[model samples]
Structure formats: structure tokens, C-alpha cells
Target: MMQATTAVRGRTERAGGKRAEWTGGLSRRSFPAGFVFGTAASAYQVEGMALKDGRGPNICDAFVKIPGEIANNATADVTVDEYHRYKEDVNIMKSMGFDAYRFSISAGTGKVNWKGVAYYNRFINYMVKIGITPYANLYHYDLPVALEVQYGGLLNRKVVEAFADYADFCFKTFGDRVKNWFSFNEPRVVAALGYDDGRFAPGRCTKCKAGNSATEPYIVAHHLILSHAAAVKRYRQKYQHTQKGRIGILLDFVWYEGLTNSTADQAAAQRSRDFHIGWFLHPIIYGEYPKTLQVIVKERLPKFTPDEVHMDMLQSVIPQLKIQNMICKLVVFLIVRIMNFLIPLASPGAADERNGVLIGNRANSDWLYIVPWGLYKAVTYVKEKYGNPTMFLSENGMDDPGNVTITQGVHDTTRVAYYRSYITKLKEAIDDGANCIGYFAWSLLDNFEWKLGYTSRFGLVYVDFRTLRRYPKMSAHWFRDVVTSKN
Candidate 1:
């Protein structure tokens, strides 16, 4: 107890401060010229018109309807109401000196939501008008509910066609203005959580009435990769010549470090990474899943057909297109079995703390622990392992508990420390020759946080859920200063 108390106090002294120690020496000028700074968000999390504005029901819409599925039986049906207040949100982003805004397009096909289309068009135009570059992502775990009900959603090959069509439509409509495109964000999470554990939307698992945890996650991941490749092929063959935009997929990666220097622990950490990021990236970059996965899963893992191999191989032909693997957050893991595979435990398994000392500081989220050095290790690992493809530090931020009062929320000194330390390590990675070009914070406002509902606040700006008002937090001001600094 004494040791734990001492550790907590030591961390508070280092991290809890009026200004984070790392911020004093860091500024916009500290990074290489042309580095992008922005905030990212998905449509389902922030856009509140789930049933209105001509939007169709997504898998989340259906999943949240189930009793006891989400926190407090909450739904995003009218969560933050960004659907009605985007102009205000975008203006807030502009005022923060952000150079780009990475937002997702959640348009559903089959009847076409023209009103939804018009809303996004206006949103994108206003950002462009105000000198904020737009980085658009096609899907972020919000699969059309109809697709799931009709043919098993991402598990079936049909989803590849559906997703390709959706990507094509987005390119045709918004490609001219949106130069940066991502086909899907964190498909790994979609597969592992939604299929493996039945934790996320379209929930399925072995124990559930539907889903085979062992096989479905692999099938969903295979289909997602095909969908990404198909979209890239379409953009390259049809749109790139005229539209002149770059396209990629977003992956969420957590840096897994061994508990000790023992050989078993080291191998366990590497295997965890292989199963996590490598499940998606290995096929995209090298045309197959990692060898570790191949040997371990053997017969259970789905085989890629020759045609599918060709589709996967297509991404490697385009050198300009890069992977936008978001360093969403990092974790320290001990070798553990999960979902019939030997991978890093998704939930907090291997304690973040060893010997009564926490790894860094714990964030409000159960899964997130603030370990800035983990960011450096994650980026450096991508460089060393994956041929150092051009990358983006896509989504990185800590969250506050949702119940904090606005006055308490705005004084976010800990979040400011989180950003300063994380970005400082990111610069260290860049200096170490990681081909990273951009960094996007996890979010711009406190909106619906998926299964956690509105209980976890990961935004730099505070949203008063009562009035749906926006108030910039200290972290937001810190970002503005860092971004606009001439020194």
C-alpha cells in the first residue's frame, strides 16, 4: 500500500501540473515542415441523426436497441447532435488552428440519403472555405444494418461488393474536394470485438445465437481487406487520374511490450502484434496474413483464393498510397490466449502496473494507459517491421470521465500533459526516421462513445449534453498554441 501510494504521488508530481513538462521545449516549429495537425471523429459517434436526415439504420443502430447493450441503455439517436450543429463544430476546429479534419462519411446506399449527402457536402465545403483540409474516411464500424441482416455483413463476400460500391459513390461525389481518403477505420477492431468477443455492434460469438468466434473474425477481416483493396483498385483505375487524391485504410494498433526480457515473453509480445496489426496490414503490404498467424490458426484460418490474392496484391503496386495506421493507444501485455488464439488480451490482462507501480497514468477508459514511450516504440516498430511505409499518427488522446462538470472539464491539465508527452515522443519517432507525416487527435468533441455511450469523454472540447453546447477545454487551447506557435 505504501509503495502504491508513493507511485501514484510520483506520477501526479510528474504529470499533474499547470503546464506539462514536455510542452516547454515543444512547438509547431519543433516538427518537420509540412507535418499535419488535426482532430478525427467518426460519423456514428458524433452525428446524432441516426434515424433522421434520411439516414438508414446502421449495425450500431440495431445493436444499441437491444436491452442492456450499451451503458445506461443509452443510444446515439440524438447524442451530441452534430448533424444539426456541424457548422458550429467545424468553426470550433478552425478556430483551434487545425490544418485538417478527419471525419467519416456514414452515408447508406440502397435508397440513397440525399439529405445526408447535402449535409456532408456543406460540411466539407465550409471546412475547405475556411482553409481546413478535409480527410474523409468511408466507414468506421457503422455497417448498414440491412447488410448484416441480409448476408452476414462483413463475414460474407457480398460485403466486399457493397463496400466497394459505397467507396465508389463517395469518390464520385466527394473525391474532388476530399483529397485524402480512408476506406475503413480500424477494421481489426470491427472483426475482433464484433465477432470474437461480441462486445461491439452486430455482436456475435460462439455462445451467442449467431457467430463462430474462432472463424468469423478471420472471415470478416479477410472480407474487409478485400473491400479495402477493391476500393483502392477502383480509385486507382478510375478516380486517381482525374480526382488526384490519395487513399488508404485506417488501423488501430497498441504497442505490446513484454513483461520481462525472457525469450518466451519477447516472443509473446511479437506474436501479439502479429495477430493485432498484422492481421490486416500483413495482407495489404505483403499479400498474406503473418506467418505466426498461419502456423498457429492453421485449418481454422480462412484461405485467400487466387483472385483474392490478386486483389490483395493490387495495393502494393501503388507506391504513393500509404497505410494510415492510427496509433489509437498502447498497452503492455503478457502472453495470453484469447478467442482461441494466442494474442494480447484485449481487456486489461497483463497488469499495466508491475510491482505496484503503474506503467504511466491510467486514462478514464479501462483499456487505455498513458505510456508515451509506447508510442515511440509502436511507430519505430512499424518502421522496422513493415518497411517503414509512409504513416500517420492518426488517433491519439486520453479521455476524462463523462460526469465531470463543464467547469471541471475545461481545466484539463492532465489531458494537456497527455498530448504534450505523446507528441513529443512522436517527434522523437520522426527524428528516428519513421515515415510519419500527420497526427490527428482522437476527437474534437465529447459525443456518443459507442458501447461506453456518453460515459467516457475523449474530446478536447467539452459538450454540455444538456444544451449540446461546445466549450473548448484547456487541451484545446494548448493545441491552438502549439499549432500556431512561431517559435
Candidate 2:
């Protein structure tokens, strides 16, 4: 267990006579020695030149073509132009005193994109040169269009082999420089949003033109778990010996709170959690799906073969388990909010408010709520429920409306408070015996947010969409001060 000093309040006055109040006393010293502090962004979300530099199209490229699929019918063809401006981004991170930068390796299907590979080579080399450690994620919702066209993507077991090949390529190629690797980012989101709700790339659902909502989500999830295990196994066997790198999977969890303290509502909340995170984490850690899921989903859930069961059991001993827990909101009646993934029996009742009270202040995104203590609950829950595995608060931040001016965007006091509060809860969780090792803010720069596109801004540095210039917001400054503070 680790202990840190209690956070104290302080205020800073901004240029326009606005006051930004935060628990400014919380500094890097609040964490254990060697703990990591950094910012995180996905390749599809931040990398521009989606089709340039020999880059092949991804499922998102094809999905954004449908009318009104993304906000403003927008595409990530040139988001922040990270493909061209990674050096500038890394400089910003270094300037802010970040110890690491978590970015994804955006590989396309079919042939190897040498230009894309060269670009990441330069990117990783520059990060190393600038003293910024690179944490590379292998997948982040952007499956190759070829794989989807070939065999239904994650729906078919074939994807497991393809993904393992891709992961092996990444490990053999970039694992030398990137010390930390995550096999997948939010696999649950991939399975649920893509198959269950039809809201994301390769969209398919019960009512959509293609896909079986009930069965496909489970099948996709099962394959994803297998894919992660295969990747880990390959890394451990081939790369881990010589490259000396660490690998794990990233999971997204929304801390679910019952609308009421009644036994039924509490049970409903538990069900939401089991369906949400337990779907993946349980299989990886315990070699099977949660009993709640097995009972509820019944035969719809795929059974792991004996060999696959042994593979899952092997994964349980992984050193690091990166969890991306954000959106500390209240849920009711086990809405699960995973669309058709849950049958009608689960009931739909996800609300940030109950009996005329909000869970906390709502953010610009429909799902994000500013319930800070929910972070503590989430981390503590993972620590207690999941055997206290080594964890990282991989992604946690809120967004402001994207339609603001550069001046308005840079003056992001709300974002400052959001980080201050949420990070404080994270410290409390750590202090209370959660073996969390690091924290990464959701994003370093605003780029093409999926589904919502540019309508939501979740970045510490504000980027002018037209000019592609970067300006660190108030939150960034706060982080620099805290992270570099000698106190």
C-alpha cells in the first residue's frame, strides 16, 4: 500500500479575471516513486493522413462515408495531421513534464505500409530523443477494411490470426523503442458499439442491414479475448526475451452506481458491471466469463474450447492490466447502455440523475458525468474484485464543446478542475491500497473523436482545426506546474 499527502485547495487567476480553483497542492509527490504521468491518444483519433503515405483505408474510413454516420459527415482523413506533426506534439508533451506518451500504431490491412512504418519510426525515435517514453497500443477501433471485407472482421475467428500477425509485426518492428504495449484499446467498445449498437465502424446490429446483435457481440468478444491472448503469447515467446518490453490489454469501464440503495437496484448495478467490464476482464483473469453473463446470456455466449481455456488461464498471470475507466455515472435498472447487447429483460434505465438530482455536472458528451469519487470506486473495485493486479488509470478526462474560439478553448478552467478532482480520487484510491501504477489524461490534443467527430473537445492542448497549430490549455499548464513542482 502507498500513502500520499491530502490534497489542499488553491486558486489561480487567469488573464480575463477568471479564477481557476484546483487542489493545487497535489503534485507528483502524491504518488509513489517511479509512478508514471502522461497523456494518451488513439491513432485513428489523432493521426491524420488517414489515406496518405501509402496508408490503406480502415473500417472507419468506410463507415464515415454513410450519410450522417459521423457528426458534420466528418472524416479523420486529416485529423490534427499527427502524421506530419508528431514532433510538435511530442515537444508539447515534454514541455508539460509528461513522463510518457501513449499513442497507437495505426496499421492497415493487406500489404505493409512502408511509409506509414517509416513515419512511426521517426515518431518513436523523436519521442525517445526528447526523453518521452512511448506506450504503443496495437488496436484502437480501426480495423483494416480488407479484414472486414474478407471475413466479417472480429465476427470470424480468422481475425484472431490476422490480429496476432499484426501484433507480431508491430512487436518485431517497434517493440525495441516502445517499452509499454497494449494489445487492444477498449475491446468491449469494439464488440458492443460495432456489433450491438451499430454506432461505430463496420457498423452492424440486429436492426441494421447485417449482424446478429445478441450472438455476434459475444462471438466478437470471445475472438477479441483470444486475439489478445495470442498477441501476448507471441510477445512473451518471441519478443519479450530480447526486446525486454511489457505488454497488456486496455479495457474501458464506466463506474456504475445504483440509482437507489435498494437491493434490486444494487443488483442491477452489479449486472451492468458484469456485462460491461467483466465480459473481458473475467475471461482474461479467471479463464471464463462471469457467472452472471453465463447465466443471463445463456447459450448465446460462446464457450471456450479446452485449449482456449488453458490459453485464458495462462493470461491470468500477466504482469500489467491496463484499465481505462472513465465516465463515472449512475445507472439504473441495469440499463447496461450497451444497446441490444443486453436483452430486454435487463431493462433500460441509465440516468445521470435520479429523483431530481444529477450524479454530478454533466460534460459535453452524453455519457460523461463529473462524478469524481466514481474514479476511486472504479479503481478500488478493480483492486478488490480483480485480485489487485498491477493497474494503470489509462484514460480519464472530460470534454468541452468544440465550437469555441481558440481563446475560449485555451481558457479551459472546467477541464482543469476536472483533472484535479478526478486525479485526487485516483490518488485516494492508490492511498487506499489499489496497486495503480500510472495515470494518463484522455488526450493531448483534440482530434477526430469517433461518432461525435469534432463536436466534442477532450484535449489538454487546443488545436485550431484550420491551421493545425497547438496551444496548451489551462489544464496543461496546471499539469506542468504540478508534475514539475519541487514541493
Candidate 3:
């Protein structure tokens, strides 16, 4: 087990007039040696030039077309123009002392998008030229429009072989230099939101005039697990010997807590997790879905074949609020079972306040609340329940209003405090024997957030959307100290 320490606190005064260092007993010395620290971004979310240079329309390109979908009627056709300005973004990381940067391939979903190929090659070469390391993700919710138009995307088993082909190509093309890779980011969100509520690309659901919310989510999720395992199998068999790198999948899970000390609420909390994280993690790690899911979901869930079971890399995204477990279970039940034809997606968690009691600080998004201790619970739960696989707090960060002025955006004390509290609890999880190797803040720069579009900013560094300029917020400096500081 690792041990926690009383290290220097991150900077908070840069945002607010109050110049108080974080009182939490956490600092640079709290983490283990060789621990990685970095910032993360996605392709569809950050990379601009959606239709340029032979690239096809991704699901994001299609989803944004519907009226009144994204906030402010926004589109990511030119989101911070990362495709044209990756060098500038890398420079920001180099200056802030981040050890790595995680970005996904936004090109052809299956076949070669030569434009995307050239762009990623340029971006990776630049990152390697500088001191920063590259961590590439294979998928981040932007499915190829071609597949969805032809075979209904993840809903069909055909996507399994298609995704494998894509993964194989990526490993062969970029695996030599880009050593760290994740197969998918937030597969849970992709399953629930896209197939259940119709909120994302390739949108389909009972409520949206198409899709079977009850069965489609499970099918999509099962195929995603298979796809991940297939990619890992190919990599281990073919590339692992030469590339000498690790591969994994990223999952997002919010911590659950009962509203009161009642048995009902307590059971609700446990059941909610069995359906949420256990829905995917249990299958990948244990080679089967949780028993609770088997009993509750019945034949709606798919089974893995004997030859199809290959345990892949598991990366748990550690953020979001501590949900009211009773409410959480009831809501998931409604969406998962009762409201089969009236499907609704799961938001961040239960209501921000339960029965007139606020959980913690609220982020700009209604679904997220500031609950630092939830970080400890999330990591510890995965550690104890899932055999403590080598883990990374793959994605953890909160958002602020995007309409704020550049001056106000940079002086973001709320964001600074959010990072300080969450990271402290993260240290506590590490101390309690969780095998967490690294932490990646949700984003390095303010880019177009999916659904919320440009309305919610979740970046350590603020990006001037108009000029595409980068400014390190107070949290960025503190992260630099946390990651690079050696005492």
C-alpha cells in the first residue's frame, strides 16, 4: 500500500483574491515515484476541420445537424482549430511541465483518412520532438457516419470486426512511437447516452422515434467490450513484442451514496453500481457481467463466448459527484426497465441536492457536483471489487460557464479548488492500496464540449475561442507543481 503525505498545496489564489493554499494534507511527495501526470482531450471535441482533406463525416458531424441539440447552436467544425494548431497546444504543455498529453484519432472511423493520418503524424512527431509524451485513444464517441448509415454502428456486431481492423491499423501505424494507448474513452456514456437517450452521435432511442433503449444499450455495451478485447488480443499477439507498450479502455463512473442510512437506500446504492460500473468493468475484468445484472437484465445482456474472452486493459475515469444511491437506483431502473419505450439517459448523478441537502459544490453542469471524497470511493471500489487492475484516473475535472470573459475565466478559483479537493481524495485512494499509476485532467484547453458544446469550459488552460490563443489558468500552474515538483 502507498502512503499519503502532507505536501505543498496547489495554488488557489490566482483565481480569487483569497490567497490561501489548499489546507488538505497533499502535495508532490504524496504520490509514488515515476507517477505520471498529464492533461487529456478528444478528437471530435478538440480537433477542428471536420470535413477537410478527405476526412469523412463522423457521428458528431451528423449529430450537430439536428436543431437545438448542442448549447448555443454551436458546432465543432472549428473547435480551437487543433488540426491546424497542435504545435501551439503542445507548446503550452511543454511550458506547463505536463509529462504527457492524451488525444484521440478523429479521422476515418474504419478506413484510412489520409488527412487524419498526416495530421496525427505531424502532431505525434512534434510531441516527440518536444519533451511531452503522446497517449492516443482509439475511440471517443465519434463513430464513422458511414458505419452508422450502413449497419447501425455499435448496435450491430459487425462493428466488432470493423473496430478491430481500425485498432490493428492504428497499432501498426502509430504504435512504434506512441507507447501508451487506450481503446475507448467513456464507453458507458457512449452506450447510455447514444442508444438510450439519443443525446449523441448516431443518436437512437425509443424516445427519438427509433432504437430500443432497453436492449440496444446492452447490445452496444457488449459489442464494445468485445471490440476492446479483440483489439487487445491483436496487439498482444502481434505488436506487444515489438512495440513494448500497454493498451486499455477508459470507463466513466460516478460514486454512489445512499441519501440516508436506511437499508433501502443502502441497497439502492450497491445495486446502482452493479448496473453502472459493473455493467462493463465486471465483464472485462471477471470475464462475465455481474450476477446482479444477470438477474436484473436477464437475456437483455449478451454473453461472451469461450474464445471471445480476453481480459483487456481497464482505465477508470474518476470524477463527477456522489449520487444519492436511492435516487440513482430508481432512475436507472426507470431508464433500464420501466421506461423501455420512454427511455431517458442517466445524467451525472442524482439530483444536486437530495431532500433539501446539497451534496457539495455544484459545477456549471447540473449533472455534476463537487464531491472530493467521491474520488476515493470510486478508485477504492474498482480496486477492491475488480482485483485492483493497474489503473489511471483517466478523466477527472469540472466545468465553468463559457460565457465569462477571458479575465474572469483565467481567474477561476472554483476550478482551482475543485482540482485541489478531488486530487487530495485521489491521493487518499492511492494510500489505501489502489493501483493508480497516473492522473489526467479532463482537458488541457477549452474546446467544444459535446452536447454542451462551447457552453461549458472544462480546461486547465483557457482557449480564446475567437483567436485560438491559450492561457494557463491557476489550476494549470498548480498541476505543474503537483506533477513536476520534487522535494
Candidate 4:
């Protein structure tokens, strides 16, 4: 029944017919059978029962305390209150017919917090009862405050032991129910935003009061990769067999198209990609950093142990970005490579790297530009580079300003359009033989967006921060029909 409906939708899309009126003629049937569709969320962003019973503060809790860190100084202390209302949220997702639910474990004190475990157990049980597969990520930017103050988070090799111990607890506690495990989500972001720019939790950077962006990002990333390997090794050694689960890491990927087709510009674009996604991924896949990075960054980049170079059960990702005008950023990265011996910058999101021109429509965020084609290039690049590993389009969505009224909010035609364009390109990539298995929108609710705080709305369900009520936006209904479609 689904295949037939999908075929009809495909024909209508090709014919430019009535199906276009509803959802651009796309639906879950539009992709391969068994491809998962869901929404993604992180612990700090959604679960707001911070410090309730036996909980501990995370680095984010500390970062937001410093004035002016988050937009409007907003905090996720109660953003969306998912900790208290996950049952309701799970119900919504089940009714929407999404195949999976992607969320993270909350950060806690060094010891296992049964209070945290109890909440997840109930949440996972509800999801299982309703047939929603749980994709649990072990970490998502929220390092326990103790970890940072005690041994220096991610920077010191000691973090590898601490993280593995934490991972062991999670695997032993939840692995029976959760089959899909992600060791970390965007570890590069954790290193870059936290250590290199001091823009995130435990903020540290060259310009900050006490950081060495020149050396710390690489050190942090190296430790993160090692930590991930340790977790994967432990899982494989003990639980993976009886538990029947697969583990992987999520890396943020961005495509860099040359500014003008000039050879230098083109070379710069390649460097941008190598510096960004290639920085962490290359090491795990081939046991070393990208050759370009090793040559440029030299000793700043760390080497992996022979034991640290094993294959993860899977290679998953959240989303891919593209930046075209990184012409100037190329020079900056080169300079940083000389000064710090690290891949200092990422490819353009929409060509703002060193003020190069942009290719497509701009969004509210200065760094974001709509470039659907970039998604195709990103997944395809990963396919070619990493021997065609299975991937999850774990996150892909745009945000509108939060100040938009409820009436104007659900009319999110722009966001709907963004999803349409990006997903279509993603489909194109899959058809071209990329090994993508699923795609999740960035969020389920307009909870706190890190850095931007409540200033951005990237949710398909419009959230009224005042009432904490969730109203399905146009995109939500569109996604519903796509998932539950029977033609």
C-alpha cells in the first residue's frame, strides 16, 4: 500500500500535479522502505528538570550563569519541560507516526543518578510500547560541571576514562531497550565552540581569559575521539552481543564550494571540508588526521593509538552545511594552521567565511543561507570518502525569529520550504547510491536553541514559551501526512 502511494506521489511530483499543493508531492513513501523518520533533541535544550531531586549542574548550567552568554541571557532550566512531560511528547511523536525518537542522556554527578535513570526508563518503556525505536545519544555538549573543574573536560586524556565509565553505566542500564547508540553528537562542535571560540559551555579560547585555541581544539578533539573509541570498545567487549545494539558517533559535515572556480579558491574549499568534517572523521576511518591537516597543523594534531583505531559499529551524522564564500577564511585557516597547527575554521554555511559572496537566499541568522544543493554534495562526499557507510540525516532544519506571533508562527511556510528543498536534495543523494538510512528534523519543539536561546524557532510544532503549549505548525501537519500517508 505504501509503495503504491509513494509511486503515485512520485508521478504527481514529476507531472507537477495536485500532490504539489499539499506537500510538494513528498512523503515517507518517497524514500526506501524502512528508512526512519523522526525529530532530534538534546538533553539540556529540552529536559528542564535541572537540579530537581539528585541532579547535578552541567557546564551549560554554568555557562548560562555568566551574563550575556546566551541570547537575552535565556536558559534551558525549564525549556519545554520534557523531563516532566516526556510521556506526552512521546504520545505526540507516536501519533505523528514517526519511526524513531532521538534524544540524549542528561548529565549528572560523577556517580550514577538513579533519578535520571528512572525518568529515562519510563520514557523508553513508553516509546517501546508505542513501537517508536529509541535512538539514544550518550553525550550532547552537556559535560557535568564536576568533570570540567576536576580534570579539565575533553582537553586532558583523563577525560577518556571518565567518559567511558559514564558510557558503561548508560550501556548497562539502557542498552537492553535502546539499540541505536551514538557516543557523541558533533564532537567537533564541542571542541570548536567550547574550546576554540569560548562561545559555548566551559568557554575557553585564545582570546578568552584562559585558553589556547591554537592547541586546545585539537587536544579536545583528540581526546573526544579517544573517548568515543573507548566507549565503542567497551560496548563491543561486553554488552553489544547480548544487548544487540550498534554504536556510532555523529559528526557535523559542511560542503565548501569554491568562491569562483579559481584553482586557489577551489583548493581552499577542499581545505575547508578537510578542516571541518575531515578533522575528526579522517582519524577514526584511517587512524590519522587528514594529510592536509597533518602537514599544516603538524604536531598540534594528535595521533591515534593502534587500539583507538577500531571501526565503530556505524558512522552516523546529523546534517551537512555548505559555505561558498570562504575565500578569506581559507587564508585565516592557513594562518591559524601556521600559528596553532590545527584546523581552525570550517567551510562556509552560506559563504560568510572571510566575507565572500553568498550563493542563495539568506535566513535570519547571519551564518545561515538556503543552499539545497549543498546537502547533496555533503552526503555524496561522505559516501565517496568513507567507503559508503550508513548515515542518518540526524538533523536538518532552519529557524525563524522567536518574536513572531502565534498566528504568524504556525504559518511557517519558509521553514516548510526549507525542509522541502533540503529533503528533496537528500533524496537525490540517496538515489545516487549514498548509504543514508534516515533523516530527522532538528527538533520536535521550539525549545531553547543554544547560544541563540529562545530567539530561534526551529521546531515543526510551534511552542508558546509562556504557556508551554505545543501547536502543530503547517510543517508538522505536512510531516504527519508524509509519515502516515496511505494514498
TM-scores for all predictions: 0.91, 0.91, 0.88, 0.88
lDDT of 2 at 160: 88
Off by over 4 Å in 1: 1-22, 311-349
Per-residue CA lDDT of model 3 for 141-190, tens digit only, reads 88888898898888889998888889899999999898887888878888
Please give the CA lDDT of all the candidate structures.
Answer: 0.78, 0.79, 0.74, 0.75
Which TM-score value belongs to model 4? 0.88
Worst ten in a row by lDDT for model 1: 331-340
Output candidate 3 Cα RMSD. 7.5
Q: Backbone collision count in every prediction?
A: 0, 0, 0, 3
Instruction: Give the range of the ten consecutive residues with the poorest summed lDDT in model 3.
Output: 325-334
Q: How many pairs of residues in model 2 come into backbone collision?
A: 0
lDDT of 4 at 445: 87
Off by over 4 Å in 2: 1-23, 311-348
lDDT of 1 by residue, 270-316 (tens): 88889888888887777778898899888777777776676444435
lDDT value for model 2: 0.79
Error of 3 at 330 (Å): 25
TM-score of 3: 0.88
Q: Write the per-residue lDDT of candidate 2 for residues 232-338, one digit (tens) a residue.
A: 87887788878877777888877777777777778877887898788988878778899999898999999988887664334443423443221111111111122
